[model samples]
Target: MKFNYLVFFALCGFLNLSAQEYYFPKANADWEQKSPKTFKIKDAPLQEAVAFAEANEYSGSRDLRIAIVKGFEREPFHQILGRTKKRGGPAGMIIKNGYIVAQWGDTKRVDMTFSVTKSFLSTMAGLAEDEGKIADTKDLVIDYIWDGTFDGAHNSKITWEHLLQQNSAWSGELWGGKDWADRPPSDGDIDDWKLAQPKEPGTVMEYNDVRVNVLAYSLTHVWRKPMPLVLKEKVMDKIGASTTWRWFGYDNAWTEIDGLQMKSVTGGGHSGAGMFISAEDMARFGLLFLNNGKWKNEQLISEKWIKKATTPSTPNANYGYMWWLNQKGDRHWEGLSENIYYAAGFGGNFIVIDKEHDLVVVTRWLEPSKVGEFMTKVNAAF
Candidate 1:
């Protein structure tokens, strides 16, 4: 018995020693900055990368007000943060081996990150599974959520795995928006969308905010608290993130939980009100994953959960649990690892993780088409 305990302690000791290798950045925007030369990264390509990024920043609407009306061909969702707080500009940083190799723009500005918020929502689901709030991803979601949201026959077949992989095809109206109305085809009308038949759950992958919201709502129910609070206490605070970051949902998203009313946050800012955070804060979140969910001797989220989170869904090889993966090597330059995955949002916001290079990259307002070129340049530097 003593020897058995000794083995357990020995393994724990090894894990603790390995955890110290990750460098968690400082808060208050005091994160250390290092030059490419310091890391033996080439000077020319690094400069070219920065210049390329600066010259080809996202030209889309920096304001959600204009972006929604002009880009989506729809109005804002029922509830959202006021339009005044939205600030859009080019900002980013590149971290190699857990240190900042290069950065540009206003990394401190809080802006709308749109669908990048989905990745954070994915993290919340990981937490739920870790805490046993969700026993199995394959278990039907209707089993846990007693509400009528999953009452229909089509919806009843949906499971947490289906939802996380964007293959649930969950049918229901949420916050005055129908599931199909979120992103109909170019020529498809709302009337046509409403009558559209949903594919069998787990058979098709579709990016729908309504279904994403269902995941958020279900998670909020299981947690019995606001998601922002859960994120802060469980993740942001643990990673030494700044206090300024916020997670929000629509205005009418409030519900009674544990005898108290709380707002159910959205996974992305498609309509509005997702995550408003700085680039540094986003990097810390990426670093946590680059280290396989270990944060300084503490396994805040289980490594098993992270593996599932990053693995490509069977139905969608390029997407994993709300995270976009570069499985085909199409989005990145050649010679880079296929293990590269990222959280991408509208306005070209990206949190790219390259495990092979031990790198984390955060970029805001970069031109969508130039991402590969920028990455190619970054790779050249190293």
Candidate 2:
């Protein structure tokens, strides 16, 4: 009787493992796809959700310049003098077990993915830590970036953890903008812009682009190479991502790195230069996280790093290390898993991953406010 039970249990385990097997496509325009029915996903509701995403227009101004002028957008200080364009229409893919279950629009067209680049930056930081370049996440930033960036009493107290949690509030001018000017309070004054009484690091969770760029510049100091190149060679190529994707910095972000001039990349396209990537490529990135940073036999990113990256910040439970946590009450839709986290960008770009369901969903040019509704419809089908 014991032998029979053991055999039955082994068979069940094998079946479960077989179901989790994934198919990663080769690097090219040709990639295989699967229907929703293949995974027992209800076809009609999924179709309805896609149709909804297709029809609904983005809530922000079509011309991003208008959005910026009207205070509806929080882009970099340089966007006014930089390149800006009307965003493309809705495009996305829903992947189940690494197979494309549903896709719409031109998945290959590379488009600007605003703050989604933050998550990519977060990944780069993880890679730095894994490579032993940055020994500890809790260490003082001034230890590596010895420049006067974190010199003051309050700034000197800042650590990598504080920056990751958006609580650093590190004060300084970066790329020509004061720390407070990036996303200043509506009633901010000159004193506010100067950060005369900057909040103590780790006690405030302010989403300031200048401070984020400070983190980016610090990463440049640690890697001693252009961030885009490091990311391309280490992460993108490993996952078979297309070469068309580009990560950019501002026009004037060049700096001398060991006698070679290198541009310090931004974490997001706040001032018009961030990660411009295809939906398919972004889907591949999301799949990496969905698989806990593994790609087939190779571990592209450490599972430990991914866990810390997704862990909620103490000050902001709905926010992780640049990745947005799905811990919000509105994020709880039927069939949604507990550990879902996502990379969200401006203009309604989102790369949501459900590790529990082994799913990845990428959306571009979607209505920002309707994301919850759209995902809820998709979850209802599950």
Writing each residue's lDDT as its tens digit, candidate 2 over 278-340 gives 999999999888877878878889989998998888777778889888885544444556588
Task: Give the C-alpha lDDT of model 1.
Answer: 0.83
- TM-score (all chains, Cα) for each model: 0.91, 0.91
Q: What is the lDDT of residue 238 in candidate 1?
A: 89
* Per-structure clash totals for the candidates: 1, 1
The lDDT values for all models are: 0.83, 0.81
**In candidate 1, which residue pairs get closer than 3 Å at backbone N, Cα or C atoms, i.e. clash?**
79-251
Pick the lDDT winner: 1
